[model samples]
Target: MRRFVYCKVVLTTSLVWVLVDVFLLLYFSECNKCDDRKDRSLLPALRAVMSRTHEGPGEMGKAVIIPKEDQEKMKELFKINQFNLMASDMIALNRSLPDVRLDGCKTKVYPDDLPNTSIVIVFHNEAWSTLLRTVHSVINRSPRHLLVEILLVDDASERGRGNFMKLRGAAASRGQVITFLDAHCECTVGWLEPLLARIKEDRKAVVCPIIDVISDETFEYMAGSDMTYGGFNWKLNFRWYPVPQREMDRRKGDRTLPVRTPTMAGGLFSIDRSYFEEIGTYDPGMDIWGGENLEMSFRIWQCGGSLEIVTCSHVGHVFRKATPYSFPGGTGQVINKNNRRLAEVWMDEFKDFFYIISPGVVRVDYGDVSARKALREALQCKPFSWYLENIYPDSQIPRRYYSLGEIRNVETNQCVDNMGRKENEKVGFFNCHGMGGNQVFSYTADKEIRTDDLCLDVSRLNGPVVMLKCHHMKGNQMFEYDAERLTLLHVNSNQCLDMPSEEDKMVPTLRDCNGSRSQQWLLRNMTLSM
Candidate 1:
């Protein structure tokens, strides 16, 4: 009986130990697997292509070549992940405003005296102080009779429709056209006036207003920073500056000169009503506010219209915090995906600049797809060069500098200027061309002695000739070389020298020693003035 009992106890002990070993192996395996997955998911280097040709299905009747491997990868990558499909809860919006009245202000009517201006204010959860100030400022400063309408476009606010109604009633009773547009999206101020004013102006100008920033917490006024002001750089990169010059001047007084920008902020602007609808107002496909400005800005600029900021007009707005809640399954990704679509479509050649500026942030794949479609449908317009040359003639091109090749040691025959020259003087100049055939010419005097190299003892030419004294051998010897026309020009005489037909000729012979018409070259300065 004792032996049987002992055998049962031993069996139970062995079974418990086996189970413990199995559990430990399973946990260890899972941990290793997790680490492996993480290692595989590292970020890739940002490599993007700016192809001249658009990628899409080939023309009708043409055989379309689709790579099987790429097709499979696309299918797998695009498979809807249920876990990623999540939406953010709606944000609470502020709708209350302090009771502020513009007393003794005469209200104006429309029809007989239509307003030369209609200020469209769009708000989500704006603070009371700023909103009222914006309204009051317009009422106080604007010509009462000429002020046509104050249209407030409201993105559905938790402040309730009642508040908007009361605000609307107050303005209406004053004999001003006060209309409320209820929406749950944000728009740039730039969209407002240009659209309304342009519609009023020509029934063809699709204009949008500039978006300015306002604060909610302090109810303090802040305008859009230059960082948010989008414009094209020399490289054709669409860049954002923090603030506009006008806003900066408001605080510091106008120190800046007026300049042209490719695109204005969409926060607070005006446009004509008729043209807004004609050109198809805001893109309907865009979700509740984000990149609508970019879409509108590009559409207006590309489609036979222009955008500008009225220097005299100003409005204040509140810049808000980022959304806390996300859409179901991460639809915000879709919104981002849409932005790239808009950029690709409008920016085209300059789209690569976006990636170069913000690497790893913008997904190039999806944007390329959308841009390709837009490019195919878009009406071919003038090249960017044409716009640079004609629309903005004053725009400056940066100076280009290059080094002069090896110079052979040559003995100086004569020194006209009394400056002394020591032995072994390095003589070279920048061999480069400038905008409008101008070239950079520079030369350096010897270290120990100062001597000016002159020909025929003539320091000044009576005819149309400008002499430039330069230091640094390469700098003074530098003349302009026109790669386009294959001409070498002297900076002083502005004359092209005749080079031997052989490509390897070192020095070209000038047609005339005297400043003749053929020798005189037209010099144009292209330095950026602003």
Candidate 2:
């Protein structure tokens, strides 16, 4: 009886162990299948054709040709949507985007405790299909638990509900953070997580997604490769430039980390609701659209908050040349007035440079800046100079320098002037004036000789030495001032300046660096003008 009992117990135990192994195998197999779907859905570069030639006269491989009869409708739609709305609808947008992130970006795991977000999409005159698609895309893609609400602020759009754009404000929202976006854009998968995660790390950190471009014509989603930081010219116009060497070096070649920008493109970004309100939201005096981006960036950086662009999140925007909406005042007038307020409130002594660049604004009424100025003092924000020095040292205008004057030939004593000169135009010496007029130049620590939006450059082999728009990178725009030789040597070509013959219309040529007197240039007098 004991032997029989032992055998029976062994058989029962063996059967139980086999059942557990079978169950584990089935569970893991199902998990792997789910992972496969996610892997395919995450890579936009590998999905679909990605190359769509649906608009105008063009063809991509296996193009989904738009019928000739549909061309006029497309033109009308483009005019309305400021994007290829027709194509956006036709393309299989129920898809993924190429993971436009650095290798390191994928390594991060967003915290589960991220704050709820409300997406605010403002539209003036937009297409219904694209607008609805945007709403649906967010609803479908975003985690339902994390998204508090989606607010559609229509600025009197006549397209969908006819009068939706005129709606003043959205209904009540429940989100801790609010994201502002244009109506004509598509959000990629895993977009909201990264943005919300960063805000969770620091509530005062205003963050932006890596903005990708959706072609206005082709409607193909284009990935933005160069992760350049946003900056502005002296005119407060926004521009994207390569990462400064110093800033990049701090990363140690890690592209996944968030990049600090002096300014942002302004339109599409996420901010803490309280921080936005606390830091004084868009200047109420400002017009419908213009200079608001720079204004907000300045306010945030100054008022104990920070702004950054998160590389992991991606959103494709339709960059249109002409906005569909109309400004009550002329667009230029509104922009000038808005910028005038920006200068008054934050620019400090550097505001004088505004008058020098656009003297008309000095006369035009910028409205009362007393309230904005008072707000700045109340916040006890850092001065614009501190922001410039600490945040953006690569800037050209009003930066650090020992000399600010004209590059003059010792023999002729003529100022190097390139005003109104086109590419390859010969740079000639004009009389030096103390006013630091257009001919006046500034020699920066980076060895760039610049003035009036132009930099000293040389074209192809032995080409005319001319003034070109500053590229702010290593190229013709970069020059080496050999103080020992007293000559301007082109960094890339290793060629020194040479004026073979002394004539009024003579174009300087680049020749071997033999250190000739014609090539020698000296800073006659340092003029303190930018």
Candidate of highest lDDT: 2
Over 4 Å off in model 1, which ranges?
A: 1-120, 127-154, 157-259, 319-335, 355-530
Going through the candidates in order, what is the number of backbone clashes in each?
A: 84, 7
TM-score top scorer: 2
lDDT of each: 0.34, 0.67
lDDT of candidate 2 over 59-121, digit per residue (tens): 221123467999899888777656666666565433344555566666788888889888877
Tens digits of lDDT, candidate 1, 1-530: 00100000111224323322332333334333346445322211000111112232211112233356655543442232211011101011121222111121112111333325555555443332233334434544445444555554443332223223333323332222222222222222222222333344444443332333333222333343222335543323344544444445543643121123455445444454444444445554444444555556666655666655433223444444444224432544544555666656655554443333233326434423543344435645444344444443222221122321111111221111211222232222223323111122212112111112211111222221113332234332334654344343444554444321143222223443343333332222223211
TM-score of each: 0.37, 0.71
CA lDDT for candidate 2: 0.67
